[model samples]
Target: MAKVNYPEEFAGFAITDTKDWNKPKYITYKPKTFGENDIDIEIECCGLCGSDIMTAKGGDHGWGSITLPQVVGHEIIGKVVKIGSKVTLHKLGDRVGLGAQAFACLNCNRCHNGNEQYCANGVTTYDGKYPDGYISQGGYASHVRAHEYMCFPIPEKLQSIHAASLCCAGLTVFSPLKRYIPKNLPNNEIPKVAIVGLGGLGHLAVQFCKALGADAYVFSRTDSKKAQSFELGAKGFIATGIDGWEKEYFDQFDLILNCAIGLSGLNIDAFLSILKVEGRFCSVGLPAADEKYNVSPFTFFGNGSCLCSSALGSREEAVELFNLAAENNIVPWVETIPISEEGCETALTRAWDGDVRYRFVFTEFDKAFGTGSA
Candidate 1:
């Protein structure tokens, strides 16, 4: 790739130091070189994700090391401001969203095989290295640049704020549910699908499971989310804190998607026991580093269940997720904060502390950074 001209400046809410996240500073940055297949989106709203908080807190998040002065928000909903000459997938003025991925070498086997999330040269939305030596920045800004293939056009029925969370949190669970959950099971005997934890990802998982025509059940530690879970179309709610909860639901689930973030106090064995023979269990949440799940060979072999992990889904899967959301009227429960230096900081801090009801979306980018290229 050839070096391209760098823009004079672009404004974004950024944290200069990894250790100090008291507040983000509104500052200008030199954006990555524009590519022919890239589209520059003027952000409307960006959702606060757990990964963003984890990155800001400073640690190596499996994929790579954290970089300083990072603009961190990947669940982005925006309007297309500029499109590269060769970009034909989307046009200027299109409403779209970019998820955890920003770019992937399309020539790679993974990219060509409809598994772009596993691309060897995958570039994340933030904390990533670009081909032109520019560090990949994220959507907590006035504008964001991403390959056309990574951008999915938001459906008209889906509002920008609501579409924001689907970019990452929704896709993280939706992809695995689509891949693992049984589709042809009878209505009476439809496989029971359990969502572990009722946080951002799990809450949306419940809605998606119902939309996909499965029996959606929430497995939470407390009964706090029981009423809300049922209201969100869940078939039932299982509070693990209740005595003999595991025994009550033993061997009941055909597929279990664990959306819980940490494994420090998780009863992995109890979760595994709920799955019937040949059941599938997949985790999409970013657990703490060094938090291990230990399973005995007998426990593993006797149940004949499969365990795995999922990351963000492909761009095509993202489009399908948005379509499903629109068709089913599925909207995430989000608290909106105006997009400003202080607003960004507040959202991040609350999200870090796990205080948000479900998700937080930062809006009003035009007022925050002005209505220009930046």
Candidate 2:
């Protein structure tokens, strides 16, 4: 193993107050004490997830009240600078990525059954606490410490910038499509899958749907994203803003994956209307706590469609997702920004305004933190 000096304190751009959360200030903080199953990572790049911005905003527009001096980022890609004695999944100097989740009880039935992401005792990568009362920080930093099980080895074929978003956005959408789409369909019997929204998660969902042998369709508010959706392997595009738009496609889709955020205006009845009987409408987007769908018990009476949501994927699914990306050459549409106060503000503001083409990844870590990149 390569010998490298680990830092006593990790530094990151943090939200000191909800008033100015988007305007993060560079600060140094202590991480939890190293444990037998933990590994220290030297962050190279971290993706800008919607959750990061929402958590920063707090109050009505955000997740909830967050711990002060919180560093919010979860799609983390870094190099293992140090590994614990019991760590076998990763090693010193190995490149890996950590997503929204940081830890889970490995002894649970859910963990054993490939649903560890839903483990009742699971911990998130940021704004989460350990049993020892140590607040977990995220990667917008020079270094982060996490349990080895939460880290996945990056494939050689994928670039760090492209692989960063896969840690969260990619995994979020991938898990649902992978679960609902059948793999044993005959070559001519391609399943028609609808991916709502054309942002970070939706774009990737289209690609994964195609990669999984399904005919991908994109459902957006307008036709503006039509061409781009097709470029991302979507076979069709549905402009849901038009009146009675769901009429033509009624009972046509095998599955509808709602990747749209801020579901306050979403037409649940219309979306569920298109699904074939017994079809699934799975959502992976996280809107504000108050933004909810007004679905009644009668919502599923027409088609018998099942409405559900998926969390971040499991460790086994993460491994499969990376391998699938590598084999299919799947790359997220990402814009790289240097990690700095000004840069973070620019990225978060644009993302909140829906100005980004797809995803934003923070790079130039060495310049920001004075720690050499791996």
Identify the leading candidate in terms of TM-score: 2
On residues 210-291, what C-alpha lDDT tens digit does candidate 2 reach at each position? 8888999999998999999999988999898888999999988889888888887799999999988899999899898778
Root-mean-square deviation (CA) per prediction: 3.6, 2.6
Worst window of 10 by summed lDDT in candidate 2: 1-10
For model 2 the TM-score comes to: 0.97
Global lDDT of model 1: 0.85
- Cα lDDT tens digits, model 1, 1-374, are 11112245667877677666547777678878888999988888999999887777665433235677888889999988788899999998999999999999999789988899999888999888887778888988878899999999999999999999999999999999988888676556877899999889999999999888788999889999899999889999888886667887788899999999987767777788889988988889877565677777666675888788999998878989999999999999999999787788788888877899899999887777666343
Which numbered prediction scores highest in lDDT against the true structure? Answer: 2
Cα miss at 230, model 2 (Å)?
0.8
lDDT to native, each model? 0.85, 0.90
The ten-residue window of minimal lDDT in model 1 covers: 1-10
Compute the lDDT of residue 112 as modeled in candidate 1. 89
Model 2 per-residue lDDT at 325: 97
